[model samples]
Target: MSYDHISESLTLLQKDWSVDPILVDFMLGKRTDVTDHAVKVGQVIFHIPYITGEKKFILWKCYWPDCHNCCERQGRLPLTSDDLITIGKGLKYQKTSDFVKNETLVATWMESGPSGNNVLMTSVNLKRKIDETESDDGTHIRCRFLDEKGACSMHPNRPGVCYLYPFSSWLENETGRARVHSTYQFTGDCPGFFLEGSLDSMKETLKEYSNTIYDYTMKYTRTTREGFSLTSFV
Candidate 1:
């Protein structure tokens, strides 16, 4: 599924809160009032929001095995070049082409370009177990790597999108750094969001997630510009 609407909303929200003291205080854990703020890295707004209510900011902690909501109903898990290489290696595929051909589907969709134009981008998505008896509404599908115990069989070498689960990132402009965003706004069903967690811990997680996303994005941009498909890259 395309995330153009989410990006557009984040862009508008950033504009609205260009100089927000409420968000500042919220980040510092000093605000008791309810409000929403986008997570950011060095002034680059992330799509994830820090939503507060009932005089406290909501925090999240993944409840993986206990709650497999994300894995069960995941819509699209786009794979990056790095993810392809790592997963191919883990699966003992000697050739990336062989792995891609056997394990993934090439998905192409239109998204809003950096300059507000439309661009068609192609990427590889991990294939999911298809249930012929079920409706094709995406709700009945699950990742192929998801095991019976609700654990990822390819945990150590899962795709980049899986690693960044419950969160996503994008560069607002081609020249700017990528910003992090929570997948909460889109999914709205993650049980993790209802639980309480440490703000510092969340920040630390965002730091790692943001860095990984930035690296993957840079590699993706370079590979696409070089006229190589994601699956063809090492």
Candidate 2:
């Protein structure tokens, strides 16, 4: 019933949104080198017709692929600037900038919104470090705190995003509130989470996690939209 350990195992996209047959094979245990390993989860991107509006969310095996392997193959885990700061402070790193370059940290900039005047929205991104010279290579950024074994060096102190992986939440256009769900188009999406009962057991917790991000995103979006204005530039 307690899949807390299991939930912490999932991670983000290794490559871009498009699926990779090779990685798929590796995950599916079809590759020669990775014959023993099998993909326990598949990712599903979908939009829900919520009362607020059509909201999008990605549903995947929150666990499996395991952080150990995920670290070796995937980019750094996504986190907000505040999360990174916490991680840096926990690691006792003097300058967070030293750990990661500005570019490595991906952000969503909403140049303009419905107001039509000018609304900017920034989204956080996860990245890793290959070394001092090679900080981030587009989508290949590595987490500086990732150990050789693919474990987060700064565990427990990680960001909310890290805590809520293989799952996500979004703002409903109708209600303008965050909504979370564990139900997804499970057809062939997540191989790791094959048992519905397992998922059912953790649905409540997953929902909670989903709303957490949703609320965070909503507040962030609201603050950014209200605080910044085009005139501020002039």
Candidate 3:
């Protein structure tokens, strides 16, 4: 949870021959050559070239049930319109308004607009439990859906943010073409980093995550631009 621990872990990982040097460098801010390319599953052979200028392989596999750090430490779980609908239905909520009122909280923050000006944006995020859980750093709240067994209660219809844990993406327009660029979200809590993962499974995960992230971003941006309020859901 602290930078000191993260630094120590990176140092320990650096000694492991199984760990990829490029990944360690990237995490240490030593390398900034992260690639912005389309997700091509077929072209991938072994390592994902998320970072260009090198042939290094960085593999990861989620250690869920064993490690619920993401669920416990992730502060904000922003939801898109699709997530609202899907999760609402999954929870047996008769109306989106009811789900929004009972299960979410509206958060307002400043973000850069298209003209590079600061604009206030509001988002609907899944509400966390009120009780605080003590950790090595201090205390933090867990997602309301996270159970005592460290499993998601609404796993089948979890939000896009939950689906894309430890991986975040953004869209960039290059020569009038939209490109989705993804990067590892190193939180120092995920045990999956540097671990072996099946290429086929990784490809499938990337394909779904890529699509979800794109849709989530577009819908979230639209909601922000349209100035949708919590009352609008009703």
Q: What's the candidate order when arranged by decreasing lDDT?
A: 3, 1, 2
> What are the Cα lDDT values of the candidates?
0.57, 0.40, 0.61
Candidate 3, position 210, lDDT: 63
The better candidate by lDDT, 2 or 3, is 3
- The TM-score between candidate 2 and the true structure equals 0.46
TM for every model, in the order presented, reads 0.63, 0.46, 0.64
List, residue by residue over 90-199, the lDDT tens digit for candidate 3.
98999999988887777665544433566554567767764322221122356778889989889878887787677665445769966555556665555576523324
Candidate 1 structure quality by residue, lDDT tens digits, 60-166: 66765667767776666667677778888898999988987887776655654434576666666667764222133233267777888888899877876666666
Select the stronger candidate by lDDT from 1 and 2: 1
lDDT for model 3, please: 0.61
Worst 10 residues of 3 by lDDT: 131-140
RMSD of each: 9.7, 12.3, 6.9
If candidate 3 were superposed on the true structure by all CA atoms, what would the RMSD be? 6.9
